[model samples]
Target: MTAGLLAPPTLIRTTRGRAVVLGLAAVTMAVEMASLVVGRSIHIGSQPLSASVLPGLVLLAALGAPSVGRAGDRDRLVPFWIAMAAGLLLGVALLSRTGDLADLLGLVVAAANEEIVYRFAVPVVLATALMVLRVPTRAARVAGYVAAGAWWVLLPGHQAQTDGAVAMVTYASFAVISTVVVARSRALIPMSIAHCVLNVITIAHLRGDITSGGRGALSACLLFLLVGTFAWPGDRPGRRAAATDDGDQDLVTDTVIDLRDGQRPSVHRGEDLTWVDEPSEDDQPEPVGAPGDRRSANHGPPRH
Candidate 1:
């Protein structure tokens, strides 16, 4: 069931279908944005429930929901583990300096929600829209990813930081890398983890946990860059193996069918032939002079 939601949408064969998908995505985004606004306004025990919890729940649901069909390669744990490790190290580094539990919680929630919205949902919608508009598949995909990443970077909520250019570049780079991972790998979990790491690092940096000249900052950046390299689908060792296995299975199935069909006897006539009984080896031949044999008996009258 979880696999279904992570699957890609069915190809839009008809223009009407594409339009409907695009329209639905647009409406959903609008509703989500509205909810975010309302959630931001309300507070619960000094924390906004909508801002912290609601988006995460929504993302969780999306992740679990069924999709049209499985797309891309099967899920691999290597990339996920790599991302988690990087996130953990970066998160620890950030948390150590800030030592604020609320900030940590906030960053966690933001990571999940933002990744779902910007990396997963938006790019998918835009790609579908572009395909519907008759754009080439590769071009549509690239455009969708780039556009979604750019949107996240330029969002007003994300812009409330110092050094506008640096913030923009930093977040935008993260967005692009995350989006690429999602696009190539067709899996959100890894990128989401990476995003969370970025959020933690950024928040820590903003809080002056890592100064401009700090080595910790440089280490975080390098670790993140390592995480980004895993975004490419070809980097997974199991991917090619999985593809090869699928091909082999297909070939075997086809061969079996062909062999079975080819070996079947062909009928030359329109109608089936009648069955004829053959004498068995155990059966005795009819007696030469049985009671019914009149020729063997002496005849009283002879032919004149």
Candidate 2:
């Protein structure tokens, strides 16, 4: 049987990864404190920076999120900015409809937490793990985002009407939309902008609105979004890789001259090998050494 622990996988940690993790830490602390002070009460009102902060957060992220893009390059900035602009327009429209700019502003801030939790924390963690497990990067990022969504949904005291449903949609969107934007822009600017603006609009539209089935719908939508995002063919295929041991342990293949009647192939060092399909008493031809053998050819017969 194959046996031995593999080395820990390596990850190309990026600024966005740090932002996501750090951002999550900040958000969790802020929300927990907000929870303690508010106690199941979420204030929904208009604020001055509702329109501005979202843009500002995008700008700030623009300065750092480029490295997270594909090939770790800075190619995706323009489209990302455009998406953010579009989202900003949508947010303003929703703000106009709901007349709750303050709540929208709050959403902008709260939405950043998602970046921390999913865009940042979960992706980084999963990417790191995948690097170790040799999982495909595309698969890793998508899986990571979905995992983060599940984590948020299951957090304690998450209200279905207020937090649960809303969080589900917002986080689900973040997972897919961010992947798309980052993939295209190779920069976080556009995606962050889109994210901020989307939250603004969502919060604005949610203001003074109530529906009974929103919770179930939100939960279902979250699951659906996660599945679709992962299944989508956005990410590039990974490179082929092979493992090698140090210089002293060059691999050697051996043929089976004999088997114990019913010996079967088994795993060794994470590889599989098959023995010759012949009975032990068949008395195979005399074994001969071809290469890499230190022992004499006239030695004992090969065993399977």
Candidate 2 versus the native: TM-score? 0.39
Top TM-score: which candidate number?
A: 1
Q: Residue 17 of candidate 2: its Cα lDDT? A: 31
Residue range with the least summed lDDT across 10 consecutive positions in model 2: 248-257
How far out, in Å, is residue 34 in model 2?
A: 14
Clashing pairs in 2: 9-132, 20-120, 45-102, 45-103, 46-101, 46-102, 47-101, 47-102, 76-185, 80-190
Give the runs in model 2 whose Cα sits over 4 Å from its true position: 1-83, 86-106, 130-142, 152-159, 162-174, 183-187, 207-304
Which model scores highest in lDDT? 1
Alpha carbon lDDT of residue 289, candidate 2? 58
Residues 249-270 of candidate 1 have per-residue lDDT tens digits of: 1111112212223222233333
How does candidate 1 fare on TM-score? 0.54
Question: Which 10 successive residues of model 1 have the least lDDT summed?
Answer: 248-257
